[model samples]
Target: MRGPAEAEAEDFVAAHTAIARPALVPEIPLHLATEITPIWQATEAWLGEQGIEPPFWAFAWPGSQALARWVLDDPSRVAGRRVLDFAAGGGLAAIACARAGAAVVEAAEIDPLAHAATRLNARLNGVAVAEAPGDVVGAPCRWDTVLAGDVCYEAPMTNHILPWLRGLAAAGARVILADPGRAYVPRGGLAEVARFRVPVTRELEDRDERVVVLSRLLG
Candidate 1:
């Protein structure tokens, strides 16, 4: 059952974005903003008028694109395992996990709009991704594998979540993070697994292509 907030989110997304395939991960389609500046401005206006945060859910960041592509190319990493996609913006990695045959998949995001977009995108990909709302950082880990993409972009956010992610790794849960040369990604404690040259919108990333790396946390 969908709540009123979720329904409102869906409606707002439908109004503001379009269903299209991202270049790096073209296998799955997502509802994304076609013009970054227009969407950002609109989101800002909405935030001032109606108290909505900027819709990060409408763009497929380079890290997420690489992560999703890697997962799809190598299903064995998540197949038959319970998977959690932390801070699952737009749920691209979660959908990849499901499509790759994960036994169970959950996408955790703090924004209601992201939750709604994730559900909608999962449905578009013909998969089921359970939405775990609210902040799940520092929460007990139950999933066999956890995926994080583009989470180190902000200094404060990186500082707050890295330790919790390290805790998950220390506890023996496989923690994989994808980063596109973010300023805050640590210089150590990671084992490089894969890399991708992801195509991205310049309006969002300021470059046409980004080199994204998928790394496993050293436990």
Candidate 2:
């Protein structure tokens, strides 16, 4: 049975977005906003009226696209392993991990709307991804593999998350970070494992295509 928060999120997402496939990972379809500004305004209006945070989960980011493609192309990376998709907006990487045969998959997102989106996307892809809300950073690493997408966009978030991710890597958990050349992505510690030319909307990325890289943290 769905909880109240989940039901409310589902209703909000259904009212604001449309089901569409990301350009880079066309195999998986997701519910996404077609117009960026309108959705942002809508979410902002909702925030003013109902005190809800802006819905960043209603978009498929380039890093996630690259990560999802990499996972599908090389399923052995996550196959039969317990996986955690950190900051799992839209649950793209989580769904990919599940499809790649991960023994267990969990998506961690702080936003209730994102949790709803993850649940909906997992169901759409015919996979199971347990949605965990709230900050999971610095927690004891339980998964065999951890996947993070576009997490370095903000300096504060980068500072808070990178160390925890590196700790997990050091502890022998495979830590894969998909980054779109964000300013905060560390110059060292991460080695580029794969790269992809991800097509993205100009409104979101300010460019037609972004070269996203899948980097593995050196333990």
Candidate 3:
């Protein structure tokens, strides 16, 4: 049985977003916001909570798009491996990993709305993505691969999560961070693996496209 809050969250997600495919990875269907401003404003009003972050899970960002594309193109990278999609907004990369045959796929998020959105998106794609609610930072690494996409946007968040991510790399997990030239991306300890030109809307970004870089986070 679902609690009232959980059911309301899912209802909000289904009501505010439409089922659509991201530009870079079109094979996987997701619940995405059609109009940016309306959804953003609506989320704030609906939540009725002050200082809530924008609904990042409503859209598939460039970093996740690139990560999903990369993994789907080469399933062998995650097939039969335990995978973690860190900060998994809408679980795009996580769904890709499941589709690519990962033995287990976990999607981690701190936002309860994001958790609901991920659940809806995963079901829409006909795949299983275990939810790792709340912060998974500083937790012991149990995954073979950790996919982090678009996670370096804010300095405080970057500072808080980067060291733990590095520790996971040191623990022998293949930590892949997909960055779309965010302001706070570290200048060192990243080995480039793949690059993608992802389409975006000017309403959300300064330009119509973002060049996403998939890199191995060096321990």
Poorly placed runs, candidate 1 (over 4 Å): 45-53
Per-residue lDDT tens digits of candidate 3, residues 105-162? 9999999999899989988989999988578999999999999999999999999999
lDDT for 147 in candidate 2 is 89
The TM-score of candidate 3 is 0.97
Give each prediction's root-mean-square deviation over alpha carbons. Answer: 1.6, 1.6, 1.0
Q: Count the backbone clashes (under 3 Å) in each candidate.
A: 0, 0, 0
Residue 50 displacement (Å), model 2: 9.2
Q: Give the poorly placed runs of model 2, Cα more than 4 Å off.
A: 49-54
For each candidate, what is the lDDT?
0.88, 0.88, 0.94
Q: Residue 152 lDDT in model 2?
A: 94
Error of 1 at 154 (Å): 1.5
Q: What's the best-to-worst order under lDDT?
A: 3, 1, 2
Q: Give the TM-score (vs. native) of candidate 1.
A: 0.95
